[model samples]
Target: MRRADEPDDRRTLERRALTEWPEQAGAQVRSVAVAGDRAEVTLTVNGHHDYWVYYRRGRVGREERVSGNGPTLGWEDPSAIGW
Candidate 1:
């Protein structure tokens, strides 16, 4: 059976991003880029840009939110995160 953590495609990656980061559940998915087993998701919520990166193992390796309160989830370095 396919587990929720193992996102293998674009749709699954998007869903996993929301499930793993519930804070961005209502956020709009601005973009989703999949390469092999990895994926990078961009979301916008409350006028701020957020990022969610799914690694080769289908797990979310990094996440970052840019909101009024600042980074709330993961690494702050933009160079360290993303696709």
Candidate 2:
């Protein structure tokens, strides 16, 4: 079984960025999780106070902020996240 905190495989990250999270270009993901086919992510940007839900891929996907809020979700190429 795979855990959410486990480092995402390069291919998984690439696929998610290209297909699932193309809209989250400039944001940085603080954490990511995958259960079965679903994915959940936590992200924050330079100007934002709170982290936001970045993306969820698969059934029952969801994104939510864990802290303060400021900036809206923005898109950046996955390469920028230093995957």
Candidate 3:
């Protein structure tokens, strides 16, 4: 019985860590929006085109583009939700 708006504890912590984009990583989050069970994020990165990321589960779910071309990496943690 998890509340819809309440992210998983571990996932929340991980997402918080991602709040600051790594200096080595070229990507920067431009916007984030959540509705029901889905989240949409827009990112802009050097050497890459602007892209949109969609999340279905929280932080542990795989991230993919709703539309556009970009490399997509799956979640490393299978048990966690939302990163």
For all candidates, what are the clash counts? Answer: 0, 6, 7
Better of 2 and 3 by TM-score: 3
lDDT of each: 0.47, 0.41, 0.49
lDDT of 3 by residue, 1-83 (tens): 22324456335423542454666767665655554455555567564657655555546653442434452343223354444
Residue 1 in model 2: lDDT: 19
Sliding window of 10 residues with minimal summed lDDT for model 1: 63-72
Superposed model 3: Cα runs more than 4 Å off:
1-25, 58-67, 70-83
Candidate 1 C-alpha lDDT tens digits along 1-83? 12334445556656655664456346666666544433456666545656544434325543322222233333333345443
* TM-score for each candidate, following the candidate numbering: 0.45, 0.35, 0.43
Candidate 1's displacement at residue 1, Å, is: 29
> How accurate locally is residue 83 in candidate 3, as Cα lDDT from 0 to 100?
40
lDDT of each residue in 1-83, candidate 2, tens digit only: 14465454423543443343345455566655554433444455543633433333334433322223433322222333311
Model 1 residue 40 lDDT?
A: 53
Off by over 4 Å in 1: 1-8, 23-25, 58-83
Count residue pairs with overlapping backbones in model 2.
6
Cα displacement (angstroms), candidate 2, residue 29, comes to 0.9
Highest lDDT among the candidates is held by which one? 3
